[model samples]
Target: MLRSHDKCVVYIKSDDGEKVVDEIKTFQDAHWVSSPKALWRIYEFNLTEMQPAIINLQLHLPGKQAVCYWKKQNLQSIVESDFVHQTMLTEYFKMCPIDIEARTYLY
Candidate 1:
């Protein structure tokens, strides 16, 4: 039977022979305690947040890209909206020439 306050014992062998060490054995502590990033996550803190935000590029043939529209919305109005024609890929291509920094990134 184990006592209420008793900790798990670990045995280590050295030149002096085997030595018993009392410890609160846990896989979580062993894996996460030594890492700063893991400790930050243990405290439930956000490690990284996108600054400018990321853009997901969409691929499609000309005039075949998907568009967002409500069921009640007219098909003609949906086709007329300027946003329907604009995708991340199109915007990236449009901005690449104008913005010098954009040229550094590969599509």
Candidate 2:
């Protein structure tokens, strides 16, 4: 389903499932990350925090969107670069957005 959108999908499992999903959406709504390199940096930096339950990681190009899913608790987290650090919780949810348009545009 996510693959059809042409956006990067990275799913992650967190201590709190609902909170993580909300956080991801917040970041996506803001329109973050200008390039793919920045997105990769965010993923490498945050990988440690998202461990164990975070079984699957999907990264779609063009859109620079990531969807992170958990294997154990069925938790999902999405992160994009557009989100600003308005609060502590929001700050922690920061991520890079996949450039979906770029992929489709080229294809």
The most accurate candidate by TM-score is 1
Question: Could you give me the TM-score of model 2 versus the true structure?
Answer: 0.16
Question: To one decimal, what is the Cα RMSD in angstroms of model 2 from the true structure?
Answer: 21.5
Point out the worst 10-residue segment of candidate 1 by lDDT.
1-10
Supply every candidate's count of residue pairs whose N, Cα or C atoms clash at under 3 angstroms.
0, 27
Model 2 stretches with alpha carbons more than 4 Å out: 16-19, 23-107
Q: What is the Cα root-mean-square deviation between model 1 and the actual structure?
A: 15.6
The true-versus-predicted C-alpha distance at residue 105 of model 1, in Å, is 3.3
Write down the lDDT of every candidate, Cα atoms only.
0.68, 0.41
Model 2 lDDT per residue over 2-49, tens place:
232224444555887742445466447543455664776777766236
Task: For candidate 2, give the lDDT of residue 26.
Answer: 44
